[model samples]
Target: MKRALLILAATAVVSAPALADEALAKAKNCMACHSVDKKLVGPAYKDIAKKYAGDAKAADMLATKIQKGGSGVWGAIPMPANPQVNDAEAKKLAAWVLSLK
Candidate 1:
């Protein structure tokens, strides 16, 4: 039973991309402006995911936007550039955002 529980825990960890990415987002201060389900200073992440649901290039575009920042896309409030997050982290964040239900 203990071995089975351990395997289940490992499986959960392996499958929980959103959980891991939420931690990354929090660490990178994304939660300051964006939330998974509701709008904050910025649009909700699930909304972003819904908007880009079918776009194949969304990941790359969003990653670039995260690093460089943009305005007039979602609203009048501009998204500030995140120089603290590297390219890889931006990509991961984009992927995670896009994965939201």
Candidate 2:
């Protein structure tokens, strides 16, 4: 029981950041057009991570795209600019999206 409890605690600690980021994404309405694994209106977070893999400037670029919005890269559907999301939150979301496997 003690070992199980320890494992559960460790799992929670390891998973907390992803959960927090997901909550932030949802709060920011990112979920309306995107998802973690599968493609939605926007590309999946994991697909974004794959496309930007090893790109040193991906976080900055993605953050800018998040705030200003863009099209032609993903599809015909343009992503609307999110004026409500500040620079910091955009960066955080970008980092989180890039972190997805």
Q: Local distance difference test, per candidate?
A: 0.96, 0.94
TM-score, predicted candidate 2 vs. hidden true structure = 0.95
Over the stretch 34-101, how does candidate 2's per-residue lDDT look in tens digits? Answer: 99998899999999999999999999999999989999999899999988899999999999998888
Displacement of residue 1 (Cα, Å) in model 2 is 1.9
> For model 1, how does the per-residue alpha-carbon lDDT over 1-101 read when each residue is reduced to its tens digit?
99999999999987688789999999999999999999999999999999999999999999999999999999899999999999999999999999988
lDDT of model number 1: 0.96
List TM-score per model, in order. Answer: 0.87, 0.95
In angstroms, what RMSD does candidate 2 have relative to the true structure? 0.8
List ranges where model 2 is wrong by over 4 Å.
none
Error of 2 at 87 (Å): 1.1
Candidate 1, pairs of clashing residues: none
Backbone clashes per model, in order?
0, 0
